[model samples]
Target: MVAQDFIVDLNKPLVFQVGHLGEAYQEWVHQPIVSKEGPRFFESDFWEFLTRTVWWAVPLIWLPVVCWCISMSIRMGHSLPQISLMVVSGIFIWTLLEYTLHRFLFHIETKSYWGNTIHYLLHGCHHKHPMDGLRLVFPPTATAVLCLPFWNLVQLMSTPSITPALFGGGLLGYVIYDVTHYYLHHGQPSSEVPRNLKKYHLNHHFRIQNQGFGITSSLWDKVFGTLPQSKAAKKSR
Candidate 1:
């Protein structure tokens, strides 16, 4: 049975209703709705604004940090080629990280009250209202919060000189992912690659949710056997 339009009471907390749907939650959340308006996460307008992110805000906020980190690596004695290699590696690593997060965290299967609420706030809202332009990109505030431990991890895993450049590359990959994600939802593609990507991503949103977890690149999907059940998969065999 197709899910009918759900009328969330703006006066009440959205989490209590949609978040407590239990078994009905998965199917309800997956059924995409076409609307520019997104549900309110909080009653406070000030806090609510933090939940919505403009796509341009990503690059505007992070690009300078990326450039700074890379430039810092150069000052720390890493050559351009070495820094470039680390940066590329970081971007490549980001692709795998992207796949892992999308599949494991964002799409986590849960039935607990808090779990469901968190899931809905983090990603289900996006799935439910796919066309809400404001929520397409993650809020910079949330991203900044996430960056702390990630930066520490990068520092520990790599040499000091490489860490800055590598982390910057990973950040760049994230920026590209967010922007590409927004464009895939809102932009018209005139080229083959983007056109296919748009199709691939839409398949994830409108078709099967278990597959095609990669956004900027489908490399992990092909490797992990989660590629969508479409002609592309058939041809790959």
Candidate 2:
């Protein structure tokens, strides 16, 4: 398909067709097609509205949960040292989880109809419309639904006294990840850390979608051997 064939209507709701995965995926991963209008996944206005979320809403939705978790952990009589260690561990775990999910799950390839549709709905839409600010962050409703199994897993592994602290730290790490992701996409960074991160993330989106899965930190990418090729190396290739 030619560039002119992929026109998007700003006034109407963005509706992706069931096919066109090949051409659409190529354009999206390389030169992203940004849209001013939001996409509609459901016929119901309320359900469709639930899928869109603002960047600030991430912290607003999760911060209280994090605070409550920590408070509950303290009230449960867990020692400061234990709670501190567990919380830090949880944050560290989140980094790995982030990398794994991005690389393995979000980027999963499928050719079947329903599988491809699910994949597009989950992550492909973001790549296709990177500038759709409302859809950049994960919706709170989806996050809450996904957190059920994670919370259950935490409960199974740790005592109630320590679980809250651990879960709190993980939740905080997620907030950081989401906020940092939004900043990477939309904010201009003056500092070295964010500047480097912005470049790294943009490279992932435009140059090497398979590599550089780490968003909050590239340490995992470095360790997992998924770091994007250097500019010099790309030029040589």
Candidate 3:
């Protein structure tokens, strides 16, 4: 028999109660916001293992990817510094994607008809059904669809050879971001790791909307001046 491990049933509906606020938003004001999945503590499952593997494996894989970049550079008669520059450039591209996805996609308000429809299709549904688990990451289908246009844009600026390493690095960054995001909501991060993420994200749900845009790293938000100063921020100030 399969071992039955930790089990939790919150029984609460998996969404924020609609219509509680004075203003009624056709898409959000009445729909549930959070998820109803029971909180399971430290229970290892296939999905959990997959997430952990990706979290641990991406950095390891980067070595070979870098090697491939080196091989390509040698074949193309480019210098080592040029190859390193490509990797750094890839990282920078990821930063922009991270900021854009967070600011525009995750934060899109579905108040308007088209906006509401697309918002739910993109992210509102996740807020409404946060515990669905399957929907947490950008799905493979959507990723392909979105990457094509962006790939075209990048091609305009550089040669076709750079796409693989550039896309690989950005995708690696995305894998890190998605896994970290899931863990933040469901995993127990150590106190030493920094609890600001918990508070920052919570505030996004409960308090204001203009703060804590960083998921994997807050560098973009810090650079762009969007990070809100929390009480901790205030004390430091």
Candidate 4:
């Protein structure tokens, strides 16, 4: 079935069919359907409802978490420069993590039935329906769940005085990543940098799927040699 014909109804439970298997799954991955209605993943209304989120919630949810971490770091007697360095380090760390996850986890290919479904729910849906405002940013609830393990990992490597600031910087980086990602999809950019970023990202979506994985900055893409070629180069070829 063509994607346009597929509709996810919140009022009803999902019933998977063989027709939605194999080739249909590949199409869903490569050429995602753009739908006016939100896609339903869970049968439980509460769980399904949590999947859809507003873009502004990224800052609203993470900014406070960042502030709390920094404030705690201050109370613990870290100097401004020390905290700044840790935070900067954290932001740097997040950029690598972002690129890694986008390139590796989000793009992993799976042929199994459940694998495709899970993949679609995680990232494929975004590719298929690029303009879905609800799915543009990671849901705060999901982000919070992920933050715990990441925070624990940071604590393992750093002192208490420095860990919060470091984690806070990482959080801030994530906020930037999400907001930048949303803007790349929905916002209009007049500046050259953002315009270039938007062009790079859209090309990743519409033209070259594997390249241009970095969203906030193309630094990782450049380092990893996955950066998309220039339009001039493509034209020449």
lDDT of 2 by residue, 11-55 (tens): 444434433344454444345665656566666788678878999
Per-model TM-score, in order, reads: 0.92, 0.87, 0.65, 0.88
* Candidate 3 lDDT tens digits, 1-237: 111221213353212222121123333422444664432212456433332222334345444654664466457766667766776776678778888877877775544445544555566555555555555666544555776776576667677667655655555566667777766666776795547676566565456554667777778888888877776777986
Ordering by lDDT: 1, 4, 2, 3
* Candidate 1 segments exceeding 4 Å error: 1-13, 231-237
lDDT of 2 at 216: 98
Q: Give the range where candidate 3 is weakest over 10 consecutive residues by summed lDDT.
A: 13-22
Candidate 1: what lDDT?
0.87
lDDT of each: 0.87, 0.80, 0.56, 0.83
Lowest lDDT 10-mer window, candidate 1? 1-10
Count steric clashes of candidate 1. Answer: 0
lDDT of 1 by residue, 50-139 (tens): 888889999999999999999999999988889989889888988998999999999998666577788998899889889999999999
- Worst ten in a row by lDDT for model 2: 14-23
Highest-scoring model, lDDT: 1
Query: Residue 5 in candidate 4 has what lDDT?
Result: 57
Off by over 4 Å in 3: 1-23, 26-33, 36-84, 232-237
